[model samples]
Each structure stands twice: as C-alpha cells, then as structure tokens.
Target: MITCKDFLSELNEYLDEDCRDEVRKELEEHLDECPNCWVICNTTQKTIEIYRGMDPIPIPVGVHDRLLDALRMKSQIAPPA
Candidate 1:
C-alpha cells in the first residue's frame, strides 16, 4: 500500500486524471482505507468540479500589468551581499 506522503505527491496528477491506471488503483486503494486522505481527496475533487463549472472572471489590465512589472522588478533585484 502507498503511504500518505506518496498519495499527496501524486495528488495533482491523480486529480488531473493524468495518472496511469496502475497508479490510480494504488491511490484509490489508499483512499479506501484512510479516512483522512479520503476526505482531503474528496473535498479537493468537489472543489475542482465547482471551480471548473464557474465562468472565469478576468483581472483588470492594470492589475495584470502591475503584477508583471512586480515580477520583473523582483527578478532583476540583486541578492543581498
């Protein structure tokens, strides 16, 4: 059986339905016996479902530009000596 840590590491791939069948079986088996992991996985799946159902709201152009500018400025900053 896979450990909780293993499940978490593959959580994103499993959630995305990008995992192989063998991996999926192992993850599902873990979820079956572990209540904590099951809750987390179930909740995450539900959240993803609702999130995907909603229409995406675009951020303002100004906000986008400022965010990009901040990233660029931060990247260009020299590390402290």
Candidate 2:
C-alpha cells in the first residue's frame, strides 16, 4: 500500500499521466483508499483544468519580481548572481 508521502512524491507525474503502468495502478489504489489524497488530487486536477481553459494573463513586472522574491525567501534560495 502506498503512503501519503508516496502519493505526494508522484503526484505531478500521476497527474501528467507520465508514470509507469505499475506506479499508476498503485497511485489509483491509494486514491481509492485515502479520501484526503483523493480530495487533494481532485482539487488539483480541477485547478489545472480551470487554469488551462483561461487565457494567459501577464503579471505586472513589480508583482512578478515581488512574487519571485517571496518564493526565494521562503525556500531559502539565493537570488541569481
């Protein structure tokens, strides 16, 4: 049986349908048995769908810089030299 950690680790590949057949089967089984994971997967899939259906919008330059700065700080990544 796959654990939540396993599910999360493979989530992107699973959603992209890029995993091997065996791994896909295990992930599906995990989703079936774990309601929390199921909801997370479902919500993420729906979010992807909604975003895909929308026209791409450009973020303002200041906001984009701020967002990147915030993410870098949160992840403890140094800004590019």
Candidate 3:
C-alpha cells in the first residue's frame, strides 16, 4: 500500500501522466483506498478540467507587477537553498 506522503510526492507527475506504469498503478490503488487523498485528487482533476476548457484570462499589469513584487520580497526574506 502507498502512503499519503508517497501520493503527494508524485502527484504532479501522476496528474501529468508522466509517471511509470508501476508507479501509476500504486497511486491509483492508493486513491481507491484513501478517502482524503481521493477527495483531493478528484477536486484537483475537476479543477484542471474546468481550467482546460476555458480560455486563459491575462493578468492585469498592475496586479501582475504587485504579485511579482510580493514574490521578490518573499524570496529576499527566505534563506538561500
């Protein structure tokens, strides 16, 4: 049985259909047996489906600038890896 940590670690690859067959099988089985993880996966899948069907709206310049500025400030505060 796969752990929740295992599910999360490979979630992006799984969603992208990028993981190997064996890993995918393990993740699918985990989803079947884990209610919390299943709910998370289901909601994320639905959200991605919804987004894919819509045209992406461009961010307003002011909002985009503010977001980048915030990110820069956060990075400055954070220690280097």
Candidate 4:
C-alpha cells in the first residue's frame, strides 16, 4: 500500500503521466482508499485543466514580485541569488 507521503512524492510525475505502470496502479489504489488525497488529486487535475484552456495573462511586475516574495516567506525559503 502506498502511503500519503509516497503519493505526494510521486504526484507530479503521476500527473505528468511519467510514472511506471506499477507505480500508477499503486497511486490509483491509494486514491481510491484515501478521500483526502482523492480530493486533492481531483482538485489539482481540474485546476490544471481549467488553466490549460485559458489564455496566458502577464502579471504586472510589482504584483509578480510581491507574489514571489509572499510565496518565499510562506515557505520560509531564501530568495535565489
């Protein structure tokens, strides 16, 4: 059985369809048994679908910089050099 941690670790690859068949099967099984993970996966998939259908809009530089700064602060990560 795949743990939530394992599911999360492979999430990006799974979403990208880059995981092996065996791993994909395990992830599917995990999603079936885990409601929370299922919600997360479903929401993310839908979000991606919605975004993919949209036209790209450029953000204003100030807003973009503030967004990045906020994300960095939230993650407690240092800014890139």
Candidate 5:
C-alpha cells in the first residue's frame, strides 16, 4: 500500500509521467484512499496548469552571459575534486 509521504515524494515525477507503471499504480491507489494527499495533488495540478497557461517572458539581455561568468568564477573558487 502507498502512503501519503510516498505520494508526495513521487508527485513531481508522477505528474511528469516519468514514474514506472507499478509506482504510478501505487500512487493512484494512495490518492484514492487519502483525502489530504488527494487535495495536495489537486492543488499541485492546478498550480502547474496555471503556470503553464501564463505567457513566458524572454530572458533579459546579457543575463545568460552574466550567469555563465558568475558560474565560472564560482567553479574556480571551489576546492578541487
């Protein structure tokens, strides 16, 4: 049997259709019996849908270059593997 914690942990992958059939079935079963988890799942679904519905904005000019330079600096400062 699946539990609420398991469902939440797998929620992102499940919604992305990335989980295996067995795991997906387990999550579905848990959702069937758990009202609180079900509400969480529903709310997450709605939030994702709303975000998807919004128009995407373009990245500000030079943002990518600035980000890459910052990342390179940070990497240089980090200890060697």
Candidate 6:
C-alpha cells in the first residue's frame, strides 16, 4: 500500500489525469478509503482546473530579448569553470 506522503506527492499528477494507469488506480483507491486525502485532492484539482481555464495573456514585445540579454550579461560577468 502507498503511504499518505507518496499519495499526496503524486496527487497533482492524478488530479491532472496525467499519471500512469497503475498510479491512477492506486490514487483512486487511496482517495476512496481516505476522506482527508480525498478532500485535499478535490480542492487541488479544482484549483488547477480554475487556473487552466483562465484566458492567456500576451507578454510585452522585446521582453524575451531583454531577458536573454540579461542572462548573457550575467553569464559573461561570472568566472569560467
């Protein structure tokens, strides 16, 4: 049997329905037998769904170039390995 810690750690994948079938079955069984974990799983699943449903916002133009430039400068300033 999987422990509560393992169940919680992998709960996100289960909620996302992105885990392996065997793992999903284990989580399903755990959720069925454990009310606390069930509540936690339900709440997290809802939260992720809500976030995913939000509309995408466009990033300002040049932001990517600016970030790359900053990273380049930072890397240049550091000593060589």
Q: Quick one: best lDDT, which candidate?
A: 2
Which tens-of-lDDT digit does each residue in 1-81 have in candidate 5? 877777899999888857788888988899899999989999998999999899987888699768867887988755345
Candidate 5 TM-score over all chains jointly? 0.63
Residue 25's lDDT in candidate 5: 90
Model 4 TM-score? Answer: 0.63
List, residue by residue over 1-81, the lDDT tens digit for candidate 6: 887898999987887656899999998898889999999988988898898899987887699768767887988755345
* Span of 10 residues, lowest total lDDT, candidate 3: 72-81
Candidate 6 residue runs with Cα over 4 Å from true position: 56-81
| Each model's lDDT | 0.89, 0.93, 0.87, 0.90, 0.85, 0.84
Cα deviation of 8 in candidate 2 (Å)? 0.7
TM-score of predicted structure 3: 0.62
lDDT of prediction 1? 0.89
Better of 2 and 4 by TM-score: 2
lDDT of 2 by residue, 3-58 (tens): 99999999888998567889999999999999999999999999999988999779
Error of 2 at 26 (Å): 0.4
After superposition, the stretches of candidate 4 with alpha carbons farther than 4 Å from their true spots are 56-81
RMSD score of candidate 1 (Å): 12.2
TM-score of each predicted structure versus truth: 0.65, 0.64, 0.62, 0.63, 0.63, 0.63
Query: Candidate 2: how large is its RMSD?
Result: 13.3
Clashes of each: 0, 0, 0, 0, 0, 0
Best by TM-score: 1
> Which regions in candidate 1 have their CA more than 4 angstroms from the true location?
56-81
Better of 1 and 4 by lDDT: 4
